[model samples]
Target: MAEQAYTVVSDSETTGEEKTSSSFPEIAIGIDIGTSQCSVAVWSGSQVELVRNTRNRKLMKSYVTFKDEVPAGGVSDELAHEYDMLSGAAIFNMKRLIGRVDTDPVVHASKSLPFLVETLNIGVRPFIAALVNNMWRSTTPEEVLAIFLVELRAMAEVKLKRPVRNVVLTVPVSFSRFQLTRIERACAMAGLHVLRLMPEPTAVALLYAQQQQQSGHENMGSGSEKIALIFNMGAGYCDVAITATAGGVSQIKALAGSTVGGEDLLQNLMHHLLPNMDDLFSSHGIEEIKRMGLLRVATQNAIHLLSFDESVPIDVDLGNGTKLSKVLTRTELEEVNKEVFEKCEALIKRCLQAAKLEAEDVHDVIIVGGCSYVPKVRNIVMSICKRQELYSGMNPLEAAVRGAALEGAVASGISDPFGNLDLLTIQATPLSIGIQADGGDFVPVIHQNTTTPVRKEQIFTTVHDDQAEALILVYEGDEKAAEHNHLLGYFKIRGIPPAQKGVPEISVCMDIDASNVLRVFAGVIVHGTQRAPMPFMEVRMPTVDDGHGWSAQALHKMYGSTLDLVTVKKIQHRDC
Candidate 1:
């Protein structure tokens, strides 16, 4: 590469404040705030530039400190990769608390955190986890999130030198609307506007497909069809999606997610440490584990070993001559985690059924996310999927964030999404969908697993004489009774003279539009007219860390981290 001599072409027309595209920043960043670690990537026109936060050092600790000087100190302006040996402080796994209600199963499970928990006890033991609280003030989970958001925003701001705002946050598919709302609020509090809420698996497909298509190797697989199964296993969740490929266009066919992630598995191991080890959260013990790099590296190594060979050694630092370190065979790992694996298998099976395809129908099976690094999980999936081929070895931990960056790029016009589409098949039911009867009975117009972007209609007569209006209830799900399923909303038709019952010729129609929003319309003979409203949807789980009298069983993991904002035009993963 030779350096070319630059001759400044002094054109008098070119003046002082030149407004060129280069002067403006075209970077889009994706933040994958996982339970174990947090990652973000910037799309710098060429490719995704991924980096781990040196301030937080690891992805995320999911612990929040109240009024602690530690979490609120010395983050250098420069990107220095130093582990925050900050003790007497709290910060870890905020992802678990992103969007949650008082009654999510995961929330209850957070009780064993070893940190002092506080907050209301709405049946969830740990209302919230706070390390330090000002005498009169306790930190809200939203405030805890404020810290993580500040850290992430700082990274983007430092790199861009401009305020970074818009973002596409990915969440678990199982997240409910209420949960999503809390997360969105968190993001809002952090000054970042959520452009869209994408599911974990979908993000992976978008990232993988974007790379494949951009490299001019779009059609790299057989059947001359473009499709991939994104198997995303992570620290706190697992997501599987059947993404179709068209010129790198991705659409989610069927998606399945679970709160049971690699971190959960690690946490289980940590429980094993509880028996063998006693020095977990001592004044300097946790820091010592971190300083020795044993906490992070050992955790990953333990996970890796258990997933591979028959067993591996477990080291627990039991101060004063009681060294607790022993080999744990893979068999023992499986024996201890049989139920978790079984649950994962069941979830995957359900996803397959939803896709209406056999395991063999999958074109490409790619594994992403941090957890899939476990060999057994991959092996079992291959066996169950009955597939001979699988792809791994990519940076699974950051793949989702990278792909998210690409999506952000496409949204920013820096690159075209080209339907490079991170295809997410909306989970709409019934092909010729219709609602239920008033008597708590089911009216099946369409069935589940029916490919959507569809339209269907049904006619109903006015129930009463002189009836000028009629209302119809809209619903979703596979229950035999109308009340059992989720009510999508309602359809109302106004304007008809009061007539005999069943006299008004009223009709109702349902449409799943391009953006996956469901539309409900009603019509009556008023110069022959019809009107309708739109349908809705995405991520996060919140946790309560305080020792509230509330029990997790009552809530059963009903945390509201994911919400349906599809119907609402202005969408944001607030407080996310």
Candidate 2:
């Protein structure tokens, strides 16, 4: 056997002396990387300490550059405050694009964000467009994430003077499997072990409910006030859930969100104020002025301020005190932000309707996410709540991150897991459960939108006599074609005996865990049906198909040592 050496990717087990620096072997940190700002907080012992910038400010601009090397800004360790210093940078609206199809509504909306759009194409991926034109250097979404993680870890490292190990990450419920995988890999690359990934709304609920209980409040209502809705709107994304509070434990009723958030509203405001910015690409070449990188940011700040009050007097520091000022009235900005309100309203209504509650039926309205600071946004949510007693105390920007840190504390054993928290029920994604058919229609074992942690089995048969193996590909999403939608994974059941056609029965069951990650199992239904039924196991995943990874022996049996590239290409497409 080859000499074995295992690397320590996570915390040391309980064999050693208790770690004195942290309550748990692994120190816990929660990072909220948002569009306008990113915040990193640590739950060391008893209190949570948020790392401040040089000026003792809490928020850090989610900006990173990749020129000579990747450098980041907005949270300087230095003692100076400068926003314009850069090497070649990209900001955080990238979160809005994660896990989206190229044509998604939010992807379209992200283009309207206050950043330069790079049209230059470099890689085979669309993520490249940001690089070739120099709006941001060519960087993968995962790489961008790695840079952010590096900066955060450095900040914590400076504070502790020791390496921080274990962490829990929070992703929006909107994340697809690939995006989640990418995030996990980025953490691995950054030399941190991810203990778990809690969805944003769920973490927020835990944080909110826990705090309420600490203040001597529980089960905020009996039967009359059974449920409350969380309206989480931020600059980069929006999430809303109808959480039921029985004695103050918030449980998810149903949840939904999108890449479109307050930033989109800001863009809408910009188009109203500066019509010229819309023609930025055609009038001025993208590479030149796009690299200047300040026009959209100035406008977005003005728009964000307007959300707080009815009107905000705008100031754009073009340079040398030559400032441009204009007053954007509530009505004018309202016309621009109408699309955002409608989308939010529709999602909220859908969630409420699914929970079988009318707008007036919901009891308490808890608004969160920084975007909720907008006066008009508060008004809209209040109208939906239809009750004066609704509590809107939580700070949206800080709430999710704080909730995430609390979850981290619990996860890493720094805090007690049995500690009381508000638990609410929420809707599952894709809305239906089904198996694929020959013609592409979904034969639902469980209907779409059903509550999850569900297991429904489907059987498959061999198409050919004397078949030794079978392939079952599972998928998620709403599409008429098998080629479209998300292909979660492909399963291969091997070691079957030669049998007549349709003799073997393959059972496929899928289960969603508490955290909602999916697992798939395939096995022979009966021991005699094959030899011994393979034990039900995990969801099979795909591997990168780099031809070079194969060994010489396997390669020789498949093909001769020297082969034509044309023949290899032919085999790839014509394997069947």
Per-candidate total of colliding backbone pairs: 85, 22
**Runs with alpha carbons beyond 4 Å of true place in candidate 1:** 1-27, 52-64, 69-88, 116-126, 133-137, 215-223, 270-301, 315-325, 416-576
CA lDDT, candidate 2, residue 158: 80
For candidate 1, what is the TM-score?
0.68
Q: Per-residue alpha-carbon lDDT of model 1 for 1-576, expressed as tens digits?
A: 000111112333222223353465445578776665566777765567775455545344444443434344122322211233233244455566545444555665554343433325453324443334323223455555555666677767776665566687777765543345556666766666676566777777787666666554535443245667777777777777776765556666777666787766765665555543333443333444342233434555777876557667777553444455777777666666777787778777887887878887886788877767677688768887888778653577777777777777766656433434332333322212345443344454445535566676565555446655444545554567654443444434556556666555555566665434456665653333533322211101122233222322222134221110011122376677
- Each model's lDDT comes to 0.55, 0.58
| Model 2 stretches astray by more than 4 angstroms | 1-24, 77-88, 99-124, 129-136, 160-162, 216-226, 246-250, 274-279, 282-292, 312-327, 415-435, 442-471, 478-484, 492-506, 514-516, 523-576
Candidate 2 lDDT score relative to the true structure: 0.58
In the range 267-299, model 2's lDDT, one tens digit per residue, is 776666656555553322343234234556566
Query: What is the TM-score (0 to 1) of candidate 2?
Result: 0.75
